[model samples]
Target: MSRFKRGAHVDSRAGFRQEKEDCPVPYGLLKAARKSGQLKSIRAVLMYLGSVPHSVWRLNIDTPQEAQQNLSFGAADLTKLLLSSNKLQSLSEDVKLLPSLVVLDIHDNQLSSLPDSIRDLEQLQKLILSHNKLTQLPSGLWRLTNLRCLHLQQNLIEQIPQDSGQLVHLDDLDLSNNHLMDIPESLANLKNLVALNLSCNKLKSLPPAISEMKNLRMLDCSRNQIESIPPVLAQMESLEQLYLRHNKLRFLPELHCCKTLKELHCGNNQIEVLEADHLKHLSALSFLALRDNKVKNLPEEITLLQGLEHLDLTNNDISSLPCGLGTLPKLKSLALEGNPLRTIRRDLLTKGTGELLKYLRSRIQEEPKTAMTLPSQAKINVHAIKTLKTLDYSEMNKTHQDKSMTTNRGCCRKATKMEEILLGESFLSFDLCKYRMLAFIKIKRGLFRFP
Candidate 1:
């Protein structure tokens, strides 16, 4: 017989016995046997060791009976514990028994508060309590300096303790979907933070100290009642993605230092002007959204964005566009719908972005060069005057003294008719002798004086 078959009838309280149906093996002896390598068969070893201390533990004890039966294990060796999607109204103080615990996830529960004994877990690194009914965080949470990720989103958190910045090593934080109206200034102490989400809140403004997060890459403060953003936002050199949609801002902040920014979403606001100073520094921008604003004109400097791919300007008051907009090479998605554009035909817009861009380029080519045009009523013609060699007033029937004062009366008669057709009959009564003397003196000298 196999060793597993021999140990099948072992009792729980007794040591390994011979031919006994009621007596079972002791737990301590089975453990010792497994430790000394006496248990050779894998089946026998599994049958002997049913539940033991592991580095990771997960339990779904929603009922009272299941909680009492399943949660009674020794957690001295546990490093991670997940009890999500349960009816856990509260956590027991016994959680402090797990000294080596590093991660605890109890999201999607009815947890309203955490026990103060949670501070005893000195090695805890991540605490995920999102989608809970937590109204306030315990004061002991700040003691977890080693914590790197803390998610308290979708909760009823009304305020964050000022000392919350004690978690200096935290990298990712999500406090969205809360009722917070303000934040603590000490939050700037989290120098290692990378991503911060404070969206879907009632915040009116952000602390000025928030600009101190030098390593931050992404920031989402959308869907709030914020009236203005701090100018210090331009100082975040490492910021790549910024979201400020659905706010009450009246203008865009000058982003002269945000050179690494890639995506900026500031749609659904009350912005009226987009100046050159607001766009000159965003050299690395790719996506810009300014939909549903009151902007009337886009500055000619907008073509400076060489890498821009998507530009959304729907429902604006813009009536014209700069011709340079057609020269951008990388623009692929341009949304000008719901605008009051009068120059571009509606049919052309319906044809899509390609046709619209082609039309703008054609307009650039069709524009005429700078030149002064004369009216049709003016019969004066100056094209025949090859260098102003003669000054002839035909109505007066006389010609000025030219290169050697040749008195060619017949040629002078033809010049009189041409002058009448050019200068009109208004010069008939003008004094020709005085003007002729002035012209001869001017031609003789290098300087010509205009009367």
Candidate 2:
């Protein structure tokens, strides 16, 4: 006899065996097999048992009553559970039964707190609770050593537990849009953290220990009350992108050690100076944004950033720009709008970035070369005049020639008329007059002239 015939009973209402009904076997086929005695082998019994694990479950977008009732199901084999977008205000303590659970997504819910039993899930790796009314996290949350990603953004959370750094395996964390006043120094213990977002918070300052996160790659602290950045931030060699927009910083921190930094955003601040030391070591920088600041001038050293691609200095007190700005090779986007720039025309600036960069480059090529050439030519002319004075010449003619050369005009007519009486010897007077005529010619053309 088949296993279904020996141990399973047919439900008369559904006209099929209870066990085979839920299986994929057809009711008529099972009836025919029973009638012919064909279901007699162990291989026939294994065909009805499917090979799919019942470990994943989703109770999203369901009514609160329905979600609560589903929780009664056994949780021994559960590995992933998604309860997002529901009306759940509380999680049952029975969640601790799922010791094997690894992923729990409860975002977009009305959860204001989590059950203390949550820490019992030692295998939990990801916990998402964003867009909720959480004002604080449970202390037991710090015990989850295997947790890799935690997103608690868009919450009313005012403080983070100092022991949060215990989750050393955390690779991504987002705490933006909260009322956080400060961060815990212990966060530096998350040595494996890769990305961190703390934007739109009330943070007044950052912990100096933040530099301990040597493996961090991206950090966003924008829209906060931060007054300054810790100098040790330059020690984070893996840092690639940093955002400090809409803060109260008055000066840019020196980043001489951040050789791998690629992008920096410090817009909407009170920064007034951009000194050489501030930009000297960011050789790999590609984007720099300083819009809406009090900066008045750009240092000549800014030209040292050969890899810079975009420069934003909009709405500043800058009145002039260094001509070297036009020589950067990789510059593609240059924003200078809303500045008090006096040298460049407003109409030309309105034409766009391309025209502005082109104009700056043209200034470099148009620098007057004549200023460098004039001094050398002047020295040669002076030497030639000194040699001419050593030649034979009468005192009367020589004095007339010196006065004419000093006045930069030909007094030859006066000299020739004076020679009629001053030097009556015809041959001597003729040669002297001829030499004076040639000197006048040379002075007229500016080849050799006396002051």
Candidate 3:
């Protein structure tokens, strides 16, 4: 005969029955309980559903029926399931009952391994198992053919099973912060893989079979000990973005045929040379980062990359430049900080790319005689014999010289004017005439010198 502790009703707008904010309860359930004479049953059910578990169920009072009734439904069709930071040592066997799960985020758990029952979730797409103590993946996980994204980052995984290639449909795989020494050849079977992040691992070299993944667009192998890039990887047609930062690479990958490449980041490596053919083939490339490498020179052929937009050569040993580099049509952002380039102007060190280009153009134009040499040569008679060293100023005179006039007469007139200028006391120095005569004799010998 215990009376049920019925709390005050809650207002929808104000959230309390008295509008003064007291502990709120539902009015509909309380009204139904009073009419059915089950007020105590309703209160116990509400309390059990709303309260968190304090301890193991008191068997004397809490029956199996009460515990089973506490389970909440309607969370089954949820796409994202987060069970992180929980005291869960193992996933519940009942999680397999959720049929509509897509993303299973259970990071920061004490799970040493995953239950094989999870493989039954055919609709599950992304599986995040980070920060767990899993030393290996379950063999049954290879059966999830529909999985497109798998994140096993920050785990205790030391080796990838050879059967990892079974994930043919996976497009993204993140195994960063692991203890792997080599990538399994089975990974090449993931033909649809667009992004593969193996950063912060202990890998020493990449497998040649990696070129088999034709759809790979982004690859991050940063912070590893990779010493060489396999030449076979150059044939990967769809590879667009590559990250090999902080590695021990001494030379760039021979990715000459990878035309779709857009960004290549190999910063903090030991690369020494960049090939001219490498730059010429990357027609679609926009960003190139070779910062903190051992590169010494840039080939003039680098200007062939008309689509290049951002170039970062910071902290390298570069000391000069190919003069034609400034003529690149699409080059916008150029970071040359910390390099010892001798050709770059001191005043233009802090200038923008446009101003730098303008300065370069002005310099090219300042030498007008040198710049006009090609066009002047185009107008000159190549077949002319007895070539005149002096430019003809008498041609503009109104009276045309008769062809029959003797050439000796013209030579005597020119030599008489030159002799007067040379013998004058007003001359800067008398020895200058001897030097001029020797220079003219040398020029005459060179003009008639036969091979």
Candidate 4:
């Protein structure tokens, strides 16, 4: 303790503050090297760590020991390593030191190559190396059998090794935005893959062998030069979503066998017609996107899509729609714009999906007078409802009051959400909104009917 009074200034005292050298915290690699206690190896490791950027040098150490004791980052304990957005030019072979690593993300870097030693990471489950400049992947990369998810998008890779099928456990593989004009036949061996993205590539066609991946759920081949799809693709039992936009396809393959398919996007193609056989088996389909195509009309069987939600037919050549489509229980968004639709007026088309469905339903409620307009060769054999003297709309609603009353607030919200997806369209007209309010009010008044 100083003998000076408490008010004395430090500047007045000689050598007021003692200086100390700044020592940075010991990161993982350095600490582990120090723990080994081999002077020569320690010197070599320290020099390597000193040269490495701060990102990977930390080794993502999660636990610590006493400050005086060197910490050994156990390979088993370092299960995850994230070195993204670090501008890393190269990781070299040192990454193999972390054999127990389960997740390694090095995206958005300048890596021109990867070390073949990466195959040593047998326990790695997810490896993200997207947004790099690598034109090729090391042969050893395919041998990582335990890998589950591998993302190599936005790379210059023109080819993939045939051995890529060795990754049996992989479920998600995104190789989009690459220069791959063709993929290897062995890619079909990834049977466990659930989601495969090959979008924005130079692929002129997809291999029919890919249909062998029975477990694939979502397959995106959009923005390619593909002019056709393999008929066998419809045989995939687990396929749910298929995207083939921005292609040169003139027609769709019959997917009658793919019952599990939910969404099929084939926008910006040259499909001039949609066959009923192609739409019939897609019973589970919800969103059917056929925008910017040459489709002249929709098949009457389109009404078979009972679960259908959003139907995007923008910029097509369609002139009419099936009245039965309005009868679909889940039918909601109906996008119809930029088409040469002569059957529907401009003002009515601009009114949006809800009003269009309502109009179609009203047309359905009318008596069918088409028999008088059709030619004798196209004779239709049908009994008119008026000729049968069936009950009218009000009569049916009165009998089915229970069903009408069951239309709860949840159903109304579903309608609102469905209308929200009608891209770039005007909202419901005032009369339409008023009619909905009246229907709900009718429920409260104990006279509920279907809206």
Question: How many clashing residue pairs, candidate 4?
Answer: 0
Q: For residue 293, what is the lDDT in candidate 1?
A: 87
Which portions of model 3 show Cα errors greater than 4 Å?
1-79, 85-87, 363-451
Shift in Å, residue 240, candidate 1: 0.4
TM per candidate comes to 0.66, 0.65, 0.65, 0.71
Q: List the candidate numbers ranked by TM-score, top first.
A: 4, 1, 2, 3
How many angstroms is residue 381 displaced in model 3 relative to the true structure, after the best TM-score fit?
23
Total clashes for model 1: 5
Each candidate's number of clashing pairs is 5, 0, 0, 0
lDDT of 1: 0.70
Best by TM-score: 4
Model 2 agreement with the true structure over 351-374: per-residue lDDT tens digits: 877888889889866662211111
In model 2, which regions exceed 4 Å deviation? 1-76, 368-451
lDDT: worst 10-residue window of model 1? 53-62
How much is 246 displaced in model 1, in angstroms?
Answer: 0.9
Q: Report, for every candidate in turn, its global Cα lDDT versus the true structure.
A: 0.70, 0.71, 0.67, 0.71
lDDT by residue (276-394, candidate 1, tens digit) is: 77886787899999999899999866777877889999988999887768877788889999899988888988888777777787876576222212221212233333223344332
Tens digits of per-residue lDDT for model 4, 369-429:
3212211112122222122211112212232232221223111222331111110111111
**What root-mean-square deviation over C-alphas does model 4 reach?**
16.4
Give the per-residue lDDT of model 3 (tens digit) for 1-451.
5598777996567733342123333445333332332222223332333321211112112233324688532211334555455545666555565545677777776677887778777888888888878888778787888899999999888999888898888999999999999998888999999999999999999999999999999999999999998999998999999999999998878787798999999999998998865676677888899999989999756766678898889999999766556777788988888999887776786978877767666764453221111111012221221222332212211233222222332322322212111111111112223223222211212223257
TM-score of candidate 2 on Cα atoms, chains taken together:
0.65
Residue 164's lDDT in candidate 3 = 87
